[model samples]
Target chain A: MSQHARGQRPEAAPFTERTPRVVAARHLTRRQGRDKAGRFLVEGAQAVREALAWQGGQVHELFVTETAAERNPELLQEASNAGIRISEVTDKAADSLSETVTPQGLIAVCDAVPQPLDTALQGTPRLVAVLYGVSDPGNAGTVTRVADAAGADAVIFASDTVDPHNGKCVRASTGSLFHLPIARSRDAAEVFAACRTAGLRLVAADGYAKQDLVEASAKGELKQPTAWVFGSEAHGLPDDVVASLDTSLKVPLYGAAESLNLATAAAVCLYASARDQRS
Target chain B: MSQHARGQRPEAAPFTERTPRVVAARHLTRRQGRDKAGRFLVEGAQAVREALAWQGGQVHELFVTETAAERNPELLQEASNAGIRISEVTDKAADSLSETVTPQGLIAVCDAVPQPLDTALQGTPRLVAVLYGVSDPGNAGTVTRVADAAGADAVIFASDTVDPHNGKCVRASTGSLFHLPIARSRDAAEVFAACRTAGLRLVAADGYAKQDLVEASAKGELKQPTAWVFGSEAHGLPDDVVASLDTSLKVPLYGAAESLNLATAAAVCLYASARDQRS
Candidate 1:
């Protein structure tokens, strides 16, 4: 380590290593990387800020561009003061490291994983969102944000869905990613079983369901501790998942358009249940 | 123009006079390109396919990479049979012409716009959506698609809103851009005037509105000839817009999350109104 490296000005090369260890850490690619490390990269200034605000000490490292640090000095200072490692990278390096364009030049490595299904059901969770096979990272992120806004107790991402830790998903969550508990499982049947054990009612949202969402959410009609299952737009909920549910609900369509986008449908259902629970 | 000059393969020259003309023709930077000329660009194959299925004759030109044409000969034949001008470009050219990564090697120049508001209001339109200051092209597009599915008679894009003809918006609409009538106007005042003239009730959707959506719709309180207004998530409907409405409705939220995304809220309200109308 050199004095020049430690006391160098903003534009000057600072760390002694030339390459910070955190910045040089191996990139995670497979599910094993996520499961083994218990950490994933959350990119963008807004998302990283939300993670810091919500999870605080849970963040392992912060990588930021010089421009981002200059733009948000307080954030950089906070990270440094909290004993979190910080590294400055070139714009090109940040771009290469980021998953989306216009990355906002900051990224955080943070700890997050699927919580146990029982933990989500422990409370009187009248509203829950179950996402099945939603592979688009942005849509998944939006659903998480929507679920949080609607005050759902938790969100369950079922099999074959995009990793919720993906950078795009974090950005699309608009900061809600940090505020909600999320559980991921390969088998939705297990989720149903947990709901059954917890004395929760399960409702599946289908385009052809006989009951309208309003009717399904009427007082005393929707069993308390409810879990609402939403499926991908291209394919409705898996037949088995649908069959396992106690009731099915639909948002009636007035026009000939095939269906609402998956996130929009989930928002509708989540808000409906939220309304019912509140009133 | 001589056949040699007109038919010179796009590949033979690095820059062709026709190339700029074609690119300019497909660009929507000018209002005349979308209005007087009644043409807008649809980038990517999935979007082009949706446009073709919904408004085939409205497509004036088809641009494709050789690879894309080889893979989708049926699409090529459909364009050719419809007398749409076809031009082949290199993958680089396609990339340059597209806004999305992985351009899908195809784009279409089409002619279409929102249907007249009056015509769309026929047959007792129970639900309508108004978008104010929603500058995000993708959000505007998703709203259009949702309005189509919810069977809303028309969508009004008020002041400061993004152009519905933006390529991303068109692509997001997934062909519903052609199915629904969307009107772009100066502000809420004009929208209010239009609604009043048409004998429709105006219901503005606000986060703090007193009435809950389900209650408003379930009671047949906001039934027939209704217009539902949604504002940007950043700056909600202007004070004037909120004050002049017949009623203001909110989607009840049960959590600490700030608010629902603009498009998501609109979809819920529209679907609620659709359900009310159906019953």
Candidate 2:
């Protein structure tokens, strides 16, 4: 790390898509490289700021196009203060690094924030969102965001679920992905075991369940430290999986609409618990 | 209408991209075409069934891959009984007709189900969801589905909002588009005028509002014939729009989430009013 005067780090030559950092960032788009390298790409200013804010300086390098450097002096200032390595990248290179249709001209390579299921269970989690075989990256991200907003203790994504650091999930999370601990279990059995050992009640967010969310919450059932399990939007929890859970809660639908989607259902279920717990 | 024997409609020629109906279905991929033709493409078996079941016979034609025809003989028999023109398409042609990554092998050409604001207002409205400048087609569709599930009378989309028939919205609606009345207003002002004329209360789903959804439901404020107005996920109802509404309701966040996305917020808000009105 070279020490330079404030606002005086000499601009390095712009790198193309072939440059090591840009190549690395693009490769992080795939799970293989991400797992091997133990890092993923964080795009946009807000996500970058949050990634940098994560304890222990996870962001190793920042890539900025010349236009972004000129337009976003503040982000550069933040990077400088955080002692992050900054490099100038070609416009085309920045475009390649971003997964969005419109590149933000900035991207950061940050360490993947994955915790072992046991690690997440160490602290008695009051409220947790367990995603089992939830394949959609967007739903996975939104649920993480909702769980974070509801001030849940953690989110556990089963190994069969979409990668938590997938670009689409990160984008939908809108920086909330960095706000909480994320755990991955190899299977639903691992998650079930974890919650049991942690002494947390397991409640399934089932559309077909007999108990209504509001009714259950009003009766003081939701105030307990609980782990709320959700599955793919198309399918609720599997029969075997549900049988293992302590209880199943359904958000009562008053209209002709059949059921709420995965992300929305999780929001309602978690927020009910959140409100009840807070009150 | 062709008077064909039961299950005996002559197999029409395979439609190339240039063929009239295929071109029309493909044209529906654009907003202009959907408006000009006054029809849209409804894909998948579930959506096709819903469109056919819609009153006044909105579905005019059905296209099927040979595989789907063999696998879903009952759907074809039902289509024939309903007097729908069914055509067999090549796998490539079926692929062309679908916008999804995996073509569902069934597509129905149905009339765009937009009702006049007056028409929506004419009915004794109990519940409705209005989307203003919501550009995301998926969100628009999901909200419409949620509104329908909550048994809302109608779903309204402001002119600037994404077309309800847009491929993404239709896909996300999970066929709910055919299950209810959809009204499009030239602007939010027009929506306001319609609601006032219909003597319905307007409640904006605002994040910053002081009122909590549960409290409002408990007090019976949500039981009135109401129109729930939502805006783009990026921004809530505009200040001027909020000033015109009867009141605003916020789904209380006990979690750390700053606010819910457009789809999730509409679900919680609509259901709160729905539960109150019903119970």
Candidate 3:
């Protein structure tokens, strides 16, 4: 590649929305396209930065508008130095590649980063979050972020959960998607088998469970290696799934709310384990 | 009111989008309209049910699509028994009043239920969540829901935060809005002052704070009447706001995540206090 093409170029007409590569990147917006192409789009400066910085993730290309390039020269410089393709695109082109109402004008096309379940759970995992039937992109991603924050070993998207590589989920993860080990599986039993094989106890965060978070912690249950299973807030863990888990514990509700949002419950449960294990 | 209009009208021509009442209810989709009308829209079966159930709240009217009315006869019957205005609307009319892509076909016009700061914090309180400059409707509402679940005494939307009555906020709260006390304030100073006067310590949930939740709880600091203040995750508590609080504590990031989402952070802090105080 020419030196001029490798880094920030001098003022020139950027590629338009019609650019062939831009058109290809836009296809990553859909799940099937992402699956077939083995890539997904990451938007906004923070997420793009994480993509570039992630050792486990590969950011194949970077697209930035002139204004975004000006505002984030360091990011562009990093992308350029990493031998990634950096395409300077027009504002319209950036908009085409974005999913948010307010496009940040910085988008990165990265490899779909989730690994196979066995690979993600390979180590002696101390804490994990396994999601089942969580189809909301935002909720799935928020739970991933909380899992990362609580220092869980990995996050498993299992059994009909939204694809973590989906745009909204990636945005809601706030770059945590690139910071942790993520895996997906069509089989719930396999996910449980992998976690158990990794020496992690399975605990379902069920709202109706007689055992509460406080009691679980007090009983030294959270001190062990554990995988906290969660279902969508709209529908709690299926009875059969709960029956398969070693135990189920609810986050104690002190107020009148009948239930907690899925992500909130995950945060409370995962952090309780983090604290107990560390203490 | 005529008996025919009191409850679910059997197969009658449903109200169209242009109907006068539907037009007025549609206005509640915007913030200014809600402020001017002193009412807001609650959509979907879950929220509408809570609006009808709230003793402290007034459900001014109920709008239901024909299918929604059929699916939720008990909800409509309850509204009728309470003398609430129940208007069946066309599917198109229901869509016009909804913010979500898939309209739930149930809507309730309810009085804006936030009380004054002084009134909301009137009694002695063990836990509270105060949001300052939290502009995202989802985040604001999610915090409210978690606060309620943690048994927080109240939620205070202070200084540039999104109105809790926002349609998206109400939907995110998932009926928790009607379950607890909520207050709004233009003045952050007054919010802190009120909590202090009510014998509550002011704790800011600052990501950059020197003290973390586990350390705070270990020190027995969380076992007291406290109001945990939070700011937007994008731009954490302003420096001045953090300084004014009695103490600031961070939720420890056990993993590579730089910080927790606002609601996630609040959940960890509030639940810690709940456990500590209860223990």
TM-score of chain B of 3: 0.95
Give model 2's TM-score for chain A to 2 decimal places: 0.94
lDDT of 2 by residue, A1-279 (tens): 122322535755678999876887788889898888988999988888788778733888988877777767777888888888888888899988788998888899998887777877777788999998898999999999888878888899974889988999999887777878888876788788898899889998888899988788768999999999999977778988888899999988766667878987887788778777876
lDDT of 3 by residue, B1-279 (tens): 234343455545788999999999999999899999999998988888888889877999999887787778788888889888788888999999999989999999999989988889987888989999999999999999999988998999999999998878987888888888999998999999999999999998998899898998999999999999999978999999999989999999988888888888888999999999999
Pick the winner on lDDT between candidates 2 and 3.
3
Model 1: fnat (fraction of native contacts): 0.76
- The DockQ figures for the candidates are 0.56, 0.50, 0.79
Best by lDDT: 3
Model 1 / residue A164 / CA error / Å = 1.7
Place model 2 in a CAPRI quality band. Answer: medium
Model 1 C-alpha lDDT versus the unseen true structure: 0.73
lDDT of 1 at B199: 76
- Model 3 vs. true fold: TM: 0.92
Check candidate 3 and list the clashing pairs: none
Compute the interface RMSD for each candidate structure.
Answer: 1.6, 2.1, 0.9
Which sequence of candidate numbers ranks them by TM-score, best first? Answer: 3, 2, 1
**lDDT (Cα) of model 2:** 0.82
Q: Which tens-of-lDDT digit does each residue in A1-279 have in candidate 1?
A: 222222223445433223544444335433566677777777776667777787423788877776677777767777776777777766766665677766676777788646778876676667788888888888888888889988887888887778887767777788777787788888777888877777778888898888777676554565466788888878888778788799888876667567788889888878777765666
